[model samples]
Target: MKKRKVSVLGSTGSIGRQTLDVLSAFKEDFEVVGLAAGSNVQLLIEQIKEHKPRFVSVKDTELAQELKSTLSDHSIEIFCNDVGLEFISSSACDIVVNGLVGSMGLKPTISALSHGKRVAFANKETLVVAGGLIKNLLKRNKGEIIPLDSEHVAIHQCISGARESEIKRIILTASGGPFRTWKEQDIQKATKEEALKHPTWVMGPKITIDSATLMNKGLEIIEAMVLFELPVGKIDVFIHPQSIVHSAVEFVDGNIIAQLGATDMRLPVQYSLFYPQRRELPFNLFCDLLSVGKLEFEAPDFNKFPCLKLAYHAAKEGKSYPIVLNAANEIAVDMFLKEEIKFGDIPKIISSTMENHKPSEPSSLDEITELDARIRREVSERAKTSKI
Candidate 1:
């Protein structure tokens, strides 16, 4: 049996670390060919020593130099910055696991697809910022995308062997974050620490904060629209605090199929890594519903969490609106994390940015990049000036 050659982008992040774990468990079935990480050089160094990938990339040349100096193997190729990310994505690999956080993942995704490499995508921002462009690339390229997001992965599993016409709607479950049960007035004053405390599934700070505001599920709504080719009206979100049922697809015949599992990210990571072939994990990673007892779900409160309503609006508008929504939200989330903005300000900033923008569909990646940068700058400026 031949090992599947794989590259992991954002190798030091939560998803990236778990991806490496999945690969380590099935080392005989996979080979790590490349890794791209940010400033966490220590962890990256450890990964390189263990996985011994042929290629690696860092955030910049300084980190690259630092990484190179500490490595005993001089033969390993090291690259840096956005160019390096593209290089690693286009390198000799059968699959690319993209766990990069922001719009930075978009170009690498395009590069991987252009080079005909499969992408195990955890970066929902890629789809949110430029879904149309990606779908066009997929139509013309041999590259494939298997989602590593729990909700999308569950929907992917549920829809397997089912025709597009048979599907009625997609129900994406959310954990409701720390503010799920909080009063609206109290939620308005949520601090950074409170927002960071996600009820289920530990993630990086940006996404954790987004989950607190229900904006993470909002982004997933846009993601599902693009990934599943569903209308905005056909998709819905349910606040399922248990998170046992990742997502479900309702058939036209009134039957619903769902994918249930533990709140473990590795389950989805493993699914994407060994796609089309379900391989054993060599360890116990199963979900026991008997112990779980009961599952509770309720409709998301759009009034309390306006970020979700903002996301649905962006998805329906279907142009540069989603891009603006994503960029603004990213900036707002950063501001909130830094204690520079209030919890309620996230949706306000997003709404303000969206209102000020003149919508235009970006036909190319360059246009999308330019627009995203511009929105981030504008939002940052506005937030700093108390304009929002």
Candidate 2:
């Protein structure tokens, strides 16, 4: 069988690294063609040497030069900055595994889709920020998006052969992060170290903080609305501490089809990489139900985690509101990560930003990106002054 050529964006991130692991495990099934990363040039260099991708990109010219000097292979092409990301996304590859974290993933996604490549999408921000634009791109281009998020991947698998009309509701499960049991007052003063302690899955600081604030799950709700083409009313989130059941879909007939798996992200990564063609792994990654005791599910506390509530409102509003919400959340999360703001301030920032914005549909990628940057700047300024 011929190997599927793959390019990994954000090659040094948590998702990007795991994607490479999946490729390493099934080397015979896929070929690495390109890689793009931010400031982690050392990890990118190691990945380049191991995966031997023909093209690679970095955060800036200095890092690109640094990477170039370290590489023994003179034939490998290197690029840098946003231009580099766009170039890598449009490179000759069958699939672009987008593991980029924030709104930065949007343009690269558009580039990949425009070039008719399949996207094993791990970046929820792309969809949350510009879902209509992405859907339009899919309609006009040959590109497709197979989600790599655990919850979305579960929904994808569950609804694979089912008709649209047969679906009643899509159920997304959350691990409720590290502060699931914390009181409101304690959670308000959560330290950076405390927020980063995810209960089930280990991830980047931005997402881990988002998880603690329940904003990550909130973003996923918007992501689900876009990816599945469902209304906000059709999607429901449950706080499942175990995270054994990734997500489920309840049929119109009251039958619920759910996808259960281990806490391992590789399960979803591998699933998205070779979608519509499930390959058996040589190693053990399956979940054992016997060893795991009872699974529990509870409704998310809207008052406790207002970020989730804000996301739902944004999804329902459905214009540029999601864009503002995402941009604000990203900036707020960054502030929390840097200890520039308290954990409780994340939702406050997002809420104020949304409140100040006038909702309108963005017609193009340029407009979406411009709005995103503007919101980020405004939110950053407001957060610093404690104005939100």
Candidate 3:
């Protein structure tokens, strides 16, 4: 079999690093064609040295310069900004792993898909903000955008070879984060350390906070809407504390099919990359049922976790509200983590921003991105001025 060429954007992030690990196992089966990182030149330099990708890009110009100095003897090409998209579009890559954070992943995703590259997407924000536009592009270019998030990946795998009419509902399971059972007052007083302590997974700080607020699950709902092309009403979120069962899909015949495995990201990441083929992996055995006791489920308390409710509202509303909600939440979460706002204030800021947003029907990437930026700036100013 011929080796597939790959380019990993956000190569220094949590998902990016693990993707490299998976690719490392299939060295002869895969080639690293390009790499991109955000301000992490040290690790980027190390990755470039090892993978020897023909191209690399960094967000910071100073870090890009430093990398050039270090690899001066090597003929590795380095770029920033527009050059990054240039490299991604023209890459000798069969697959592009878009692991970028927030809405920044939009342009690179469009670039790669326009060139007919298969995309392994970890950037949920892109789909959340502009799923219609991206899907349209995929249709135009005859490209595929596969999910890298475990929940969406689970749904994709379970629904494979199954007709949409056969499926009744898509169920998304959530590990209710550190604040799962905390009282309202207690959650209101949660510290950064508390919010970051995810019960089931290790991820970036922003996502962890989203998990705490249940916004991550909310985002997943919107992601599923576009991915499966289903109505938001048909998608459901259940708080599954064990998280052993990644996600589930129910059929119209009353059969509930579910995907279960150890809580490891590489499982999903690998699945996205090599669909229809399962590879051997070295991971801990099944989470012992006896030790785990009973797996529990409950309806999410939307009153307490308003972020989740906001996500569903935005998704159901189906205008530009989801973009505004996502962008504002990203800014609010950053502020909360930086000690600029209290933990509970995260949702408050988002709600406030959503109130000010006038929803528009964005028909293209440019329009969606414009709305995203406007919400971010407005939310940032609101967050800075708010007494919370």
Candidate 4:
């Protein structure tokens, strides 16, 4: 049998790096055909030396030129700008692992799916931004997407081989971030370092912050709605501090099925890459009953984590609201990380952006992109004048 050809976008981020770790462990089962990243040339250089993918993309010309000069001995195709991502994703690889951050991932996912390639998606924002678009492309090209997030992947597994009608509701488990038990008043003064401290899983800065704000879980709720074709009302979230049970499903007959695993992302990544088949790995053994005695679940405090409520609103409102919410959250998270906004201001900024905007029917990817740009610009402008 031929090895599966794989292309990994955002090759230097947390998900991308862990994805490479899995591929490295199962190198004989997969081949690296392409890679893409932002401005992390030094690490990209190292990945190039190790994986030696035939194609790679960088953020811009300077990084691309630097990468090319570093690998002068190898005849490789390199690209910069959005076109680079397009070219890499459109390649004839067997699968594309889109681990990119934010709306930039929207196009690569479309390109790969449009070309009929299997896509293992870690880029939840792509679906949040353009779920309808991706669904249409999936129909046109006969491609399928596998979920790479732990929560969604767990839900996917529980729902697998079962009739969708049997499902009562799916429960998405959250780690409650680093501030799960923080005092209500303290969250307003939370610092960048504090928010970045995820309680369970190690992740990139953006998602780490998102997790703290519960926006990550909120975004996951929207992604689940799109991926499972389930109504938003049937989806719910709970605060699970241990991160042991990633997600669960309740049957109409009063039975509950769940997928339990450690916090390592490699499990989900590998599971998505090789669906319906479980491979052997040495890491992340099942949780010990003695060490992991009891599990706890709590309702998310909407007042403290209003970004989550905003996400639910966006998901329910439909149209361009979800797009605006996602774009605004991305910008607001960036600003908050830079100390331009207070911790509590993330929801405020996103809410303000959504309220000031008019939703549209963006049938085309170009429209989505244009709308994303407009929302980001508006969010930044609002931030400049925001009295936080």
Per-model C-alpha lDDT, please? 0.93, 0.91, 0.86, 0.90
lDDT of 1 by residue, 299-327 (tens): 99998899999999999998899999999
Which candidate model has the greater lDDT, 1 or 3?
Answer: 1
Output the number of the lDDT-best candidate: 1
lDDT of 1 at 1: 88
Across residues 1-388, which tens digit of lDDT does each residue of candidate 3 receive?
8999999999999899989988887787789989998888889888887888988888867877888888854777788865785576458899999888888888888888878888998999889998899879876865788889999898987887677788899899998889888888899889999998899899988889999999999899999989888898889999999998889999999989888877878888888889768777655545576777788888899988999999998998988988988998899899888988888888888887778777789878778878888888888776666632
Instruction: Please list the residue runs of candidate 4 whose C-alpha ends up more than 4 Å from where it truly belongs after superposition.
Output: none
After best superposition, candidate 3 residue 152: deviation in angstroms? 0.8
The predicted structure with the larger lDDT, 2 or 3, is 2
Model 3: CA > 4 A from native:
282-293
In terms of TM-score, how similar is model 2 to the real structure? 0.98
Q: Which ten contiguous residues of candidate 4 have the minimum total lDDT? A: 281-290
What does candidate 4's lDDT look like per residue over 3-77, in tens digits? 999999999999999999999888889999899999999898889889989999999999888888888646789
Model 2 segments beyond 4 Å from truth?
none
Better-scoring candidate (lDDT), 3 or 4: 4
Taking the tens digit of each residue's C-alpha lDDT, what string does model 2 give over 252-294?
9999999999998899999999988888975588889988888
Clash pairs, model 2 backbone: none
TM-score of 4: 0.97
